[model samples]
Target: MHYDVFNGDADGIIALLQLRLAEPKSAQLVTGVKRDIQLLDSLNLNSQDSLTVLDISMSSNQQGLANALQAGADVFYVDHHKAGDIPSHANLNAHIDLDAETCTALIVDALLQRRFHLWAITAAYGDNLLSKADTLALQAGLSQQQAAQLQELGTLINYNGYGEDVEDLHFHPAELFQKLLAYDDPFAVIADKHSPYYILKEAYAVDMTLAQSLVASYQDSQLSVFILPDTSSSRRVSGVYGNWLANQAPNHAHLVLTLNSQQDYTVSLRAPLTNKQGAGELCSQFASGGGREAAGGINHLPKASLELLIQSVSDYYQVTASST
Candidate 1:
């Protein structure tokens, strides 16, 4: 038996698509929303079975993966996440890269060459490598309009993965994959006048509208914070809100904090476009979160420590602004 495990978002789906197009294998797909990492543990892989994992964090499934490898399962793991102490095993083939600018789709595209390269570009755009995706699109002979439409599709799909649960999402990531797989090329799918693209566009518009209206903005000299409502809608749209806040107040670094179901907060930090780095490290100092220098997030922050966390973030912003 062979299993294909991936993140359910555009990057993961597109990465697996490229692999399938190149290798042409029959494998079961295991995936969830953007936050659902370490999906390999749920599967039952035998000693002779092969597992292909893509766009998921190795650290989250380290122990289960080690056990799988020890059981003689052949594992080909490809991801771009913070990996800690990868195990060495003859059955394990790991391709883990933690470059902030690179995503799994781009990595697979590089490994597989131009085969399904347009899908790779869409995944890259979904992952927010807009400039890189545009450049690659040109190289792949995509007209400017075509590239932009693909970019929008990627962004929309990525946006669909943001909600607190499947209910909050535009469509389940797996269902989105089913729709995507129906078309050979995403460009063709998006260009069709009566395609799923129109459905996704309407959903995006509704979500963006709710996101824009829910922001509670506060500013002090150099620091700004947007306290979002504690709702599924807010959780689903936090990242987009953060980006909008950052752009609107280009002079101030923005913090977006929303309450989750557990009464804890999920926080996303973005440095000013001017200083586009170090928010990850700052968040990691006081909570469980880490990402590239430009952007990062904390999964669950206790409500008791919310004030302290905000103070620390504000202090860091002031200190950094002062030093610069």
Candidate 2:
């Protein structure tokens, strides 16, 4: 059996979508909420099996990847994250770019020679690489209106991927991916009234409204932190809302923490847009935390550690900001 394992977010979904569209494959789908990265461990592999992994960190799945290789499963992995050390194996094919400006979908787009350029642009938008996406859209000769449409579509698709679990999402990642498979162009999805775009758009508006009403729990010169209640809306909106905050204050780092069922915080950290570095490293300092340089997350942050997190983030960014 073959499995297509990916992150449930826009970057992951669009990366796989481009690949499957370029070369249609009938493979078992494996994915989960945006924060659910350790997906490889769940599958038991064998010599006859093959896997395609996208948009997930190699460091977090090192053991599962080693097991897959030992089990003789052919693997193709692509990502843009903090990859500690890549394993050298005959059956493993890895394409990793730690560049903050790039994402898995863009990498896939390059590999596919931009056969699905618009989709990649949308993924970039969804991943909150607004400037990069805008540049790409302009380079592709897209009109202002056309680019805006893709950005909105990407945002909505990305918004659906957040949540504590599948239950909190508007559509399960797999189901959303399947629904999206019907359209080669993202514009088609936006144009189709019955498409997931409409549902996600409406849901996104509601969530964003609630998130916007929240004031910063902690705010300083270099950093701002918002603490959200333990609601499905908070879980579903935290990441994107963090992105929104970062965009609003491009010079200040932002942290959005949502109270989870475990009574701990699910943390989303975004490095200042001007200094897109160190978020992953900062989050990695705590347990259940890791991510890319520009954006990172901690699945569980204890209440006692909250002050420490705020301090660490503020100090790190303060130094970085001063140096620059």
Superposed on all Cα atoms, model 2 deviates from the true structure by an RMSD in Å of: 0.6
Off by over 4 Å in 1: 214-216, 220-223, 243-253, 271-276, 279-288, 312-324
CA-lDDT, candidates in order: 0.76, 0.95
Candidate 2: residue 166 lDDT (0-100): 95
User: What C-alpha lDDT does candidate 2 achieve relative to the native structure?
Assistant: 0.95
TM-score to native of every candidate shown:
0.86, 0.99
- Residue 167 error, candidate 2, Å: 0.4
Report the C-alpha lDDT of model 2 over 1-324, residue by residue, as the tens digit: 999999999999999999998989999999999999999999999999999999999999999999999999999999998888999999999999999999999999999999999999999999999999999999999999999999998888888889998999999999999999999999999889999999988888999999999888889999999999999999898888999999999999999999999998999999999999999999999999999999999999999999999999999999988999
Estimate the Cα RMSD of every predicted model relative to the unseen true structure.
Answer: 2.8, 0.6
- Report clash pairs, candidate 2: none
Off by over 4 Å in 2: none
